[model samples]
Target: MSTRLPALITHLAHRHVSVPGLLHSGFGGTEIDQAHRDVLDHLAHAVTAERHRVDEAAQTVMRGATTVIQALSHQMRSKIDEMQHRYDDPGLAQHLLGLDHLNEQNLRHIQGTGVLCGAWPGLTHADSHLGDIVAGAQSRIRGYHRVQVTSQMEAPVAVVARAVEPIAITVAELLANALHHTHGTLAIDVSLHQAESGACVVIDDAGVGMHSDETEFASRLLSGQRTILLTELGDPPRTGFAKISRLMRQYGFSVSIDKSSPYGGVRAVVFIPGNLLTLLDEHTHPMSAMAPLPRPTSPTRTGTLPTGDAGGTGGTGEGLPRRRRRDAQPAGHLPAARPDQAPTPEETQATWSAFQAGTASGRAASRTDHLEGNH
Candidate 1:
């Protein structure tokens, strides 16, 4: 009887350790009863079911909160747009632009939260150029000036209407992650490449790369193979990868961060399948496109910041176009320029004016479309 008693206690101890795990992993009460019918198994099953219920309730709350935030953000953006048009003062306009940028970032956060909580990315009825989408995503983040984009596609590629916002959100999250991990002055390189089966937006940063374990975890999250719970995300929870995973499951695109960058950082690639791609006719006008913030008007190469008084042409250093610091010259001195080798200030001013005019036209067209749709 003593030997049998020892064996029985050991068996109970094993069950004690394993039952909670199995129940938490979704083992039903009936399944547990079939294996070992006992009061402990029943209690564990009830506890796990309650825990799942609480998680669902929390997710619903999160979704509702994000929905409210998103609506508010949209209203704020519309007001800002109105103010931008009402004020002609360059100084005030610059401040408004900065405010608009911040509001965009806020909207991104809210959208990401909504996605993680099972809400869809906001609806868009018009298709957007893929390059413009990436540019728009870059503008949504804080380090927009530090990103250098190089597009290598032979022709313009546009994302379908339904997938536009999801792709933008995913790229923005990846860019934000890259920017967050990197330190000051390091540029993020974004290159768009055409793949045989689809197109890829590749982002690379010079920040410290992820460890193997971290990479593996991110891969699992991005793969959508494992279910993710908001409770599992740490304090000030990181929902970027999880949001990307959810979007991938809903949308048809795929993202990968397992590759290392040439800059010794992370190389994140977002591949949009051919089914989601449509060719943009050269003569077609943009439709409800999200315009990228105007880049600093400075004579500098990609990934390099401009130096002294980069406000372009006759512009004062008092607005969003103002550039603060100068970059060092390259090693070899250039030969003296021919008479018309570089663009004259007048020419630069004309180019800048054209760009502004085009942006205003796009905005006006978008507003007209919105009004027409309402009718």
Candidate 2:
């Protein structure tokens, strides 16, 4: 028997109050009574039944739709690849091949959804370096060219096989979020740091950051119990953060956003607990401190910060200089290319050529002054 039951009943009896209406009737109960227990039990059972029905229907429909979408994305990618190979004009081929990359992104999104909704297959992998996973994720983002990767993780250390891709996927989603929200011209810095125990991957972007309330909501979503229903998502759905949240819960990692960034933008930090990491080389000592990788060229050709007011077109600036793009013409003729913007024929050709030739390695902008962008 509940210890408080007799007291609660006695108190309610003295007050001449019905327990069922205690809450809505504006008379709060200090203890639990039989009526309260019965009411809570009945509501719990009803909610459980309703929740099961809703989850079943949502999963069935979403899984079916995403599967169809996945099939189409694959077919589209094959045709785009074929077209890229056939075209002699570099510009035309570039235009056609851009579709292929977008298709791949779509496929990843669907697979992420499948993982979330309980349709995707089990995670599979062999041991891979944390740096390699970071590279894989950077390669998948839309504005990969604008991202700079700095890793102290060197070749000798590796994430345990089981945690590699999930970590990669979570990092990619964070990068995608940064790129999507910022002007494509801005630099996004992704850095890797090794803890004495685990590791951390931090992504900093020069995008409009989220509000406090938004952060709270996102925090709850990321760290909450895995009891969410599909219906709770928005109409078209926003699965980027949600997808990562699910993975973090399942795979034993932690994620936090906008903790620290020099650019006044969003900073996403992923904490990989020590349990998920291992040293690949038996002889080589894993560095407790980070070592810098080769830095990539800045946004400007001259590597001088562009001339603009702090609060002007782009955003914040502390006056660290960077050169302008060599290829960019006047502001009239030169439209700023963004990740979400459809690529022009010429731009596509240039990017595709870089990808094909394998000389297109981009760096993450880890420096603090590079945080702000030029208009």
- Please list all clashing residue pairs in model 1, or write none if there are none: 307-326
Give the winner by lDDT.
1
Every model's TM-score:
0.69, 0.64
The CA lDDT at 43 in model 2 is: 58
Clash tally, candidates in order: 1, 13
Worst 10 residues of 1 by lDDT: 366-375
Model 1, TM vs. native: 0.69
- Residue range 1-375, candidate 2, lDDT tens digits: 243444445443243533334434343454454466676566556666776797878887777676666556656755766676678586677655557667657767876776667554233455555666676676566767677666544223457766876887888889888888777677677777766546788887777888797676578788757465665566777777788888887889999976467667888999887677654432232211111332233443332122222112132222322222222122212123454677777777776764543311211101111111110
TM-score: which candidate is best? 1
lDDT (Cα) of model 1:
0.65
Error of 2 at 355 (Å): 3.5
